[model samples]
Target chain A: MTERFDFEGNAWVLGDNIALDGELMELKYALARETDPEILRHQIFRGLDPTLAERIRPGDIVVTGRRFAHGNPHIQGLIGLRGAGVGLVCESIHSGSFRCAINAGLPFLPRCPGVTALVKPGDRLRVDFATGALQNVTRGERHQFDPLPAELRRIVSNGGWLPTFRQRLAQQN
Target chain B: MGQTLAQKILSRIVGRSVEIGEIIMPEAELVTVHDWYAANAARALDEVGVTELFDPARVMFTTDHEPVAVSPHAAERQQRVREIAARLGIGHFFDVGRGGQGHVFPVELGYIRPGMYIAGYDTHVTNFGAVGALGIAVLTEVSELMALGSVWQQVPQTVRINLHGQLPAGISIRDVAQKIIGELDPDLIDDAVVEFAGPGLRHIGIDGRFTLVNTPTELGARSAIVEPDEIVRAYLADRVDGPVELPRSDPDAPFRAVIEWDMALMEPQVAAPPRPDRVVGVSQVSGTRIDHAYIGSCASGMIEDMRETARFLKGRVIHPRVRLFVTPATNRVAAQMAEESLTGIIQASGAVLTPPGCGVCAGGRIGPVAPGEVSIGTGTRNDPGRLGAHDAQLYIASPATVAAAAITGEICDPRGLDPDLQPREAAHD
Candidate 1:
């Protein structure tokens, strides 16, 4: 992933079941047609907050409640998130979406206890996806999320599984 | 610690024993591509600067997603996909009409077997677990699987289900799935596997078991599976060569939770629109009216499902207000239903018969639910906007229940139907 391991950004805190499709990204765009991430950028979270696309600048953070990415694993949504340089700090993520995010190289922190409650909308926050250290500059607190497993971190470092896989096969030769 | 079925399967494929919750990479015996991913998977491999498959013979591709190419673009895509498959030396490409439904055909043709670890590009690949084979739904990372020709899976904790009693009339395995799902919330099954065991396995055969394993994802489980026995062995006798290895969990192997189903107390379960987990029995939903009803999909579109649906519509026509769509799960199922005149019965009863292959089940590209319409169908998932118009109210039910709804033009109980069509003999015997 070209994404940095640690980054500081404004938070867009959301509640539980904040979906990747139909909520964060419009379903018609994410699931049905376009695969280009740049086109996807104009649609992310516009369904939830009509002004989201313009407001969600590069290096922004989304701290959502449990079961993030609740619906189908239509993955182009994550592509949009990565395209806009958005980072995520969620209480949890669904399995399919988790895999999609890993492959798309979207930087996210999952299983972050007390993070959603401490962080408020528009609060400034810094997240280290590698170490699971989430710091809320507004509230002046730091919370430890569960760190990525060794294999997960490796995938994240190399811009997701496919690129890492490509590298591995190349090394073998 | 005694390892679970997942642990044991991973152990065999990796040539070493594994324990629960350990992440291990294992080479797959089979990895299939549906039409949805066939063209993309091929392009993705090329994008990553690769031209060769790890072992082409181990890979399979199918044309089930859009079995009948809907548009010129689709037909052209199909042609290009064929060319790509040939270029890659990919083995076992089940072309349109040949593949039937991607999920169901591999079982019928015998590429999936008990104890074999299979991987596919769709989430419903979990359907493979019905026959006791482990199917890992590689949703987005399929490119990784394509490039690597293997997969990494975290051995999930098993949720044990011990079934008892037979499925009562109006209570198909679909209802049993609901009964099991009623107890599980999304959070409970994040990375879990449901393993079915016990004496009740004698009754649920391949068809019922397929319906059983198909819906665990709605509850967030990674996959659901049944243990392989003589029935499974017999089903795969011709398809699988040599004596098959049916791995079993050690008796004392640990499970995260155990659920015992007393099928006698069960009734047809209905999931009202917008969600599959929000379930109720058929009686509670007796009077809910419907505008449309469906009886197919990879979920409930099968030989047994078609046979079960034929009983209610044998001589009775559906209500005039309802538009009934009955699709066979595969070309083979369509052929079987026609041979037995079951297709004739459904058609003569005022239902529009669609050809085999997932018609409206995949987001209504073929026959999406109409806006303001209320419907019931055997296809999985009633998530809002999943079937058709965002406001469409879609109910998910068993094929029998869907047929009953088709008959009355509303969500009526199949149990309230005339007794002759009911499965009283099987339930009471």
Candidate 2:
């Protein structure tokens, strides 16, 4: 049940204010209460880029500008992104979305002030979710940002909130 | 190095000094879940193999979302909710007819006190901030608090907003809230606790302050609180049994940013469809046709809003083309409306009175607008598909503005209506 703390992946860069409700995944899927990741993976970025989901490979990276996942804190997008086996590095993310990312077990670096300018689409990148070390292999660029708080990291690394809750129960018992 | 009100409350809870961005697990004074998420919370608790709550006395459940249980499925859900509450030994259960909206009634019942920290499953829990309480929207995380007794929270930086001057006649505090959110920089408010202060606050009453505190969550603020003042004290004096602790921020409190607003310059605002922040002066959208109008929600369903609507629609009727629905926030508000004859006046004016709950704002579970129809309301958000039909256009404004639109069948400036019947004392309500 251990998730990787560090990984290398192909980069997919996006702009700011990418909303979670309509742009990430269709709102209807979330309304329908679709939780199976395998079924949701195809809907990731389906609205913005119809073919992007098919193009995304496992262990890929999504580098976004300020206010990534800006709208309603629906976790369907995070669930789908996790299903696509990708991690995220954004200049900023709303607190609600940050919670959803952790709950969905999506590895992300939520604060990288100039990350969008440093990385380009299709670039090879390496990210350490534990240390917030981001390296752009294709461009020979490196940047560091504050990692997720240790308490929150434990939740994400434990594969989302449910497993963490189960562990808490076990500890109490 | 004075701490803001948020830090003060968190520090009191954690039994230690807390700084901004520091993660701390503080026991919640109250944990609330509504009918919409009650079953999911029960399932989560079951999956985690936890059968007991940390303290049943601190936990509350309310059936406000689907108050009437229109469908068989809804009725069955309510039945399961009752069973879950019974099984968990929930201390406070506000069934459909007992309590109104979970957000509004808690304040009316005096469960929310100054400096108290609450964790709620719904975003509008910020409504409790009207009395200086911090009610963070935990969403599905309420289950964790229910089982573990505490949830982790980062002490958020406070955005200090100083208000001055008096609002012009006919303009509601909702307009001031909308204008503030529309004008403030997103970076200043994003994930920050908005603290209301300055002289203008004295002019806003409890219900108006509720609208002020409730609106900022739509702008991504973690929570909003008004520094407890005489107004809060006078409101809670009779409602609460214990000596109220009114906390105030120090003169040198650390604030992420300070923005001062002159309420005199404020105008009636409408958040056009597709987003709540897409705000414009009412004159800009005047004459826009609307088929439906609503004057309720956690944001604007107070008795003050009811009185304001009654003032506008007193001897007149809503346009025949428009269907107006007025929902009081709680049973207390409904009763107050009845006592004041506001209900009869509104009903005589052709507006329908829905149950004293979320009404049409609960995803349009009741009185949904048809597809392609335009509507205006006093609800918190105007997001697409927010009122049932994805294609249906929705605009957000104050109850006075909605009533004005309901009478005119279009988005007209409320000030353009009868001058003698204007809501001059709405601020004092």
Candidate 3:
């Protein structure tokens, strides 16, 4: 189901997995294996574990490694995760990810340094999109970050353009 | 008190005593639409009971994103867009391959002009800034503005990036561009306008300038512009109604921030691994084998790209294992390359040249990375799930670098190749 983001104590370890927890079962697969030389050098970004999608839910955050936006900023990656109902929290962002998040209105939480070490695989982490903080229940650590300004936060939270547009329209009339 | 081009344009358009960082909302003169979102916006019009919101004459529409309706599901989506455009009274609808990408065709058709504020749903819509227009990417709030006939925007503070020194041999506009983005934090410039200036500005081509303006969305900048010069005038001369002079910034203009770069010392660089800003010289990542090397996209496909590809691949064949694809940004680019026999050199060297239409650059179609495979391309935006697989990697580079990578199956420097083969002349304007 769906869960609104709530801040909790930080005690989790982070690893890139493409699993989502929700009514819609989703799993992201790697295009190339990590061991392959071709995959190692030219593959988009290695920190992304495609399998993280299998267990993620609406409010859970994705804590990834450096260069989170390493490949093309295909809407499918963020859109698929969003469709499966998960909010993203990454350590760093790339130009392509920045474009995808803004254009499609996806909310991406960036600049959470050492976030991966603070959370574990399959760890239920709490993050507040409003204030830009992460809490790990398992590790008992708290990560702080700068929040998105109201306008940008509005675009990301409404699940990108469509919902954002709908919300803005409601406000006008 | 340095001023940016966006600041100058906003000042002229809004004509208010605006302070730095105060949002200045201007009346947009021309708004464009594609069958995808524009049609969606049109439907919203009917839902809101306001169908005649936008002037049909000023509004334009095109269908590029979903071409030929590969799947039945896709076909249905296309039908919906067409119905919306037809019902909303939009006149300029472009079919697959008929109209070029919205950004290129609008300027070609003389719809976009200098000193005008233009908005489109697509991010690359910023490409129009090359023609000296204040082109900004609009979100749904903007869609509401278009349907209701207005958009709200704060006049953002302006940032002037003084670009000086000629780009050195073996380096390209793309390399310099990535360096700039790498230098800035994405959050620092959100909702701001970025303008490029300085004497070295003359060395950049219009296509290259478009690359910089195009990705402002990534930098969190509200809009971006390059002060128009001979390069812009020459490009716009034949297309405009009269002798169109380029716009320049006032010497005494005010700016919120100013940064400078020495283009000469910049080397052939790559946005390595995961982030566009995680940039490093090709030497650092050299010998990193590549599985696929591609050249051509709206960002890098130009006459210069083809010439570079041919020059690099003249006597060399692509690495046996690395698959290569090249799609010219426009038919004009493709046709010119074919006429010059550059296409022959590219194909004979084992590279596949595909038809235009943003082919693989846009996801869900061609050139996506297969799981863990690595492919270096000239296209912009190397995010996860690009090139087909989330784990797939994409490296950004110039056309020459892309071609050289194809030959060696690694991220090799283009300058390291044969110096005897002269690169093609850079396009003026």
Q: Report i-RMS for every model.
A: 1.7, 1.1, 5.5
DockQ in order? 0.56, 0.75, 0.10
The ten-residue window of minimal lDDT in model 3 chain B covers B420-429
lDDT by residue for model 3 over A71-171, one digit each (tens)? 33344445554554556677665544554555444455755666676667766577787788766666666778876566656566555655555565577
Q: For all candidates in order, state the fraction of native interface contacts they contain.
A: 0.67, 0.73, 0.07
lDDT of 1 by residue, A8-99 (tens): 88999888888777787877886476767788878888868878888887888988899988777777788788778888887888877887
Model 1: pairs clashing at backbone N, Cα or C within 3 Å: A1-A158, A1-A159, A24-A45
DockQ of 3: 0.10
How much RMSD separates candidate 2 from the native structure?
Answer: 2.6
Error of 1 at A102 (Å): 1.1
User: How do the candidates rank by DockQ, highest first?
Assistant: 2, 1, 3
Local lDDT at B418 for model 1: 38
Candidate closer to the true structure by lDDT (higher is better), 1 or 2:
2
Better of 2 and 3 by DockQ: 2
What TM-score, over all chains together, does every model reach? Answer: 0.90, 0.97, 0.71
Tens digits of per-residue lDDT, candidate 1, B56-172, equal: 898888876677777999899899889988998888988887857788888987778787788888778888887898887886557667667776787778887888888765578
lDDT of 3 by residue, B1-429 (tens): 645566666677777555564534566676777655765676556666665655665566665554446778777877777676677666676666665556766765566666667877767777777677887766444456666555546566667788888877777787887778777865555556777777888888877777767665555566777877787778777777887756666777777677787786446878775555667878888887899877866567667777877887875789998988887766667778889998898889888877655656677365556888888887767766656787887787778778888887888877867444343321210
Cα displacement (Å) at residue A91, model 3:
17
